[model samples]
Target: MEPILSVEHLSVSFTRYRRGLSRAELSAIRDLSLTVEPGQVAAVAGESGSGKSLLAHAILHILPRNAKAGGSILYDGAPLTPDRAAALRGREISLIPQGITYLDPLLTVGAQLRRGRTDPDTRSRCRKVLERYGLGAETEGLYPFQLSGGMARRVLIAAAVLDSPRLIVADEPTPGLDVKSARRVLGHFRELAEQGAGVLFITHDLKLALSVADKLVVLREGRTVDELPAADFRRGQGLTHPYTRALWQAMPEHRLW
Candidate 1:
């Protein structure tokens, strides 16, 4: 099957002025590529500055003003231009942001979830979706300020999934939760993939990601070092890159840290 999302030979760089007005370009992502197929969970893993989040923004066409992009991002076999990304974003493609700050303090949870839709059915669906995330009906009235960190994150997840998007870009989504909660959140991502939606799960936590990812894209220094099945990391087999093997060995479960 054609991938629901394909990022090929993608690079992102920032234009900056150095001393004496000399221009300098800081490349944050270099020839990075990955794909997410329908009914699959693909993970991008590396330390901070590996450009995982930038890849997500690139797909959404939300890169910063000073940033330049190269190569292609295709969705369903066609080039995903900025106009297309904008139109599809929030409807067919959703972002589960890494930070809870993405939530608006002024808007109540229900309003944020509705995203300006006031239809009776939308309201009903919003309530049901929140409930699915272990949030109650009363959560609808709570603002971002009123929610705990974990609760706020759950609210973000609930809101992002409201559209039943075909593609989900989740950036470091499980940071603040307990192990059980994090596992539960990853479980939901798997559930979404099982329902035929493609998921791109970006994180620095290799261990947490392996719990749900179908394929693992190992990144290092802004480039893809290895792309392997999740089972490779599980069995410590089929990983060709040294960094990839090191990461697997460093997992706490391996006690080689």
Candidate 2:
């Protein structure tokens, strides 16, 4: 099956000015590659500052102005250029950002989801998306300050998926949620993947990734260290990289002490 999202040999670097005239180039991501096919969830797992979020930003063409990206990113078999990314962003590409802080403090829930558009169809779609996430119609009338942590998280997801994009890039989306709510969110991602969407689930939690990801791409220090089926962790097999093995052995359920 053709992959919905393919990132090959991707590298990102930033140029920084030092002192009066000197400059330095810092590499944040190096030769990272991963793929997410239709009806699949591929997890990119790594600790903070391992360039996990940079991968998402690069794919969405939202990298910082000083950042430079190398290699190729393909979406649905075509090269994903800046113009293409800009065109598809928020329509055919969706991002479930890490925090509820991404929500607008000034806008009502409805306005935030509608993106300030008052069109009837758009409003209706926004409401339906919220409803699908178990949010009530009255949710639209409330401000962000009025929402609980879980509700704000749900709102972020509802807003991101309002258009039903072919690929979903979620960056540490379960942070701050209780286990039940986190599981519920992960279940929703699985459902989306089952409905023919490709999902790139990024996080630092190997346990969470194993719960729902079909494939796990272990990233360490901005590089692809291991790419294996989630079942490998389940079966205690097929993990060759020392880092990968260490991660497996260090799981709470596997710890001897």
Candidate 3:
């Protein structure tokens, strides 16, 4: 089966202006490539500046104006242009963004989850999704400010999967949650993958990635340093890249720091 999302030779650079008439280009992501197949969870793990979030924005066509991106992003074998991405976004492709600020402060949870549809079916699905994430039907009446950090995060996850998107891009989705909540969210991603959806789980937590991902792509200083099975990472095997090995060794279980 074809991969649902394929990013090949992806590069993103920002044009930075220094003094008058002086400018330079800074690359944030260089030559990054990965694939998320249906029924699979592929994760990209890196430190803060390693460009994991930038990859998600590039795939969603939400890059900044000063940023210039090169290379091809294919969705189901077709080039995913800006227009195509916008068209498919929310319906077929959904982003569980890194920040809880993605939720509109003015809209209620139900309103955002419904996405402007007031039909009975839409409302029912919205309630069901919220409940699945440990939220109650009464939670829908709450605003962004009314929610706790963990509640806000769950609201975002509930909204992302409400439409049953085919490709889910979750950037740091488990942050701000308790262990049980985090596990529930990750388990839901696996369940979605099992239902034939491709999931791109992006985060800085190597252990969390290993727990939920089938494939792991390690990034360092804007480049893909290693790509291997998460199983290999768990067992500390097949780690040829020095950076990847260092990351594995730094885990608490290994304690080789």
Per candidate, the number of residue pairs that clash is 0, 0, 0
Evaluated with lDDT, which candidate comes out highest?
A: 3
- Model 2: per-residue Cα lDDT over 1-257, one tens digit each: 99999999999999999999799999999989999999999999999999999999999999999999998999999999999999998888999888688888999999888876888999889888888777999999999999999899989988888877889999999887778778878998898899999999999998899999999999998899889999997777978889999999989898878
Ranking by lDDT: 3, 2, 1
lDDT over C-alpha atoms for residue 56 of model 1: 88
Steric clash count of candidate 2: 0
In model 2, the runs with Cα more than 4 Å from the true position are 116-124
Model 2: which residue pairs collide?
A: none
RMSD of 2: 1.8
Which digits, one per residue and each the tens of the lDDT, describe model 1 over residues 1-257? Answer: 88999989999999999889999899999989888999999999989988988998999999999999998999988999999999999999999988899999999999899989999999988998888778899999999999999999999998888988999999998888878777777888998899999999999988778888999999988888888999878999877888887887787788753
lDDT of 3 by residue, 45-150 (tens): 9999899889999999998999999989999999999999999998899999999999999999989999889999999999899998899999999999999999
What TM-score would each prediction reach against the true structure? 0.95, 0.93, 0.97
Model 3 worst lDDT window (10 residues): 248-257
* lDDT value for model 1: 0.90
**Which residue runs does candidate 3 get wrong by more than 4 Å?**
none
Better of 2 and 3 by TM-score: 3
